[model samples]
Target: SAKRSVVSVSALAVGDKLPSDIKLSYFDVEGNMQETTVGSLTKGKKVVFVVVPGAFTPTCSLKHVPGFIDNADKLKAKGVDTIGCVSVNDAFVMDAWAKQLGADGKILMLADGSGTFTKAVGAELDLSDKGLGQRSRVYSMLVEDGVVKVVNNG
Candidate 1:
């Protein structure tokens, strides 16, 4: 169950760079918090950012994140510097969800609470009808040295 969407409007392109002003920090498995600034995370690197609508949901918990988790090694082998998972959830929930799905080893889960980063990247999807408020759409972005190369979204 993969969600797909055509690039409508100016959602994202194959050669856009990630905005460097925003910094993100989220909780870890041990309840300790770790904050990651864009400068430190994306400096001179290619990063893959995957977004999910919600955490612990049916499609997400069962398929979406796991798909990336399973394929992370292959992606890395292809020269990806880091793989990140983004969601509308807060740090604690994101932290726990990552561990539960065994994604901690394969991906870095970032909490996009307040949809700050979501709206910033133009990746926010309206799921109010589905009881999901201001959640991120199911999508993935390939970034080269911090510049966006391609964005696939639903």
Candidate 2:
């Protein structure tokens, strides 16, 4: 599938404060709705927020999501708090996808329908060629207590 908007993350790095105050919603694969508070999600432990252009895309479905989903237990053993999957889609879409991928319980699927959070983190992607406009880049960030620790496999 082609993407319309591409998203990118700029100037955010380790030790820098994250904008956890942003409001967002996400959906499970079963089409359930969920509203989330970033701050509360990162209350303690390390957080890994992974952003993708879409849920069922070739790369994301076959590799990206699997990498984290397969390694979720390993990360937890390392004291990691949570894993988030974000996209510029609606809560229902995200929710449905998460459930489809069995990520409803392990991963936090966040919806950035307006691209507000995606732009804030500088992870916006430019997918004009593919038709996904201004969506987040494929990557993951490790945040500790609302501060960035590292952006992995970006």
Candidate 3:
């Protein structure tokens, strides 16, 4: 018999460098959809990147997102440059959620609409059984200069 080899891939973790070309969408101040890359956001900056399964969900809406919004200033004071909240939803939904939660200026609402960014980071969450389709796994990371220094996933 021939020997078989198995390779295992894992989600983004500490010491991993974020992919530079992974694109995400966001609604700008003028309500225009804007495209940005993770590398661009984390370049030469200390970013607190948060990922939620979906927008407007109970936990995300009531706690996860709000926690970041409420502590935005404190995070900034602790040398955080940007606090980004990313969800597997469209830019429009993300913008609306941001407005509804009063996170308009405090957090950068990022939309991984097509799950491109989520898949790239190996954080895809399959919720098809619940009819929610593909989504992102809940996680938070400290990214600096395009490199992940710390990561927490749930």
lDDT of each: 0.81, 0.79, 0.90
Question: What lDDT would candidate 3 get against the real structure?
Answer: 0.90
lDDT of 3 by residue, 1-154 (tens): 9998743233887899999898889988878889999989999999998899999999889978899999999999999999999998999999999999999889999998999888998988899998999999888899999999988765
Candidate 2: which stretches are off by over 4 Å? Answer: 1-9, 28-32
Q: TM-score of every model?
A: 0.87, 0.84, 0.91
Top-scoring candidate (lDDT): 3
After superposition, the stretches of candidate 3 with alpha carbons farther than 4 Å from their true spots are 1-10
Provide backbone clash counts, one per model: 3, 33, 0
How many clashes (backbone atoms < 3 Å, residues ≥3 apart in a chain or on different chains) does model 2 have? 33
Q: Alpha-carbon error at 121 in model 1, in Å?
A: 1.3
Candidate 2, poorest ten consecutive residues by summed lDDT: 5-14
Candidate 3 lDDT for residue 116: 89
Provide C-alpha RMSD values for all models, in order.
3.9, 6.2, 5.9
Pairs of residues clashing in candidate 3? none
Candidate 3 — worst ten consecutive residues by lDDT sum? 4-13
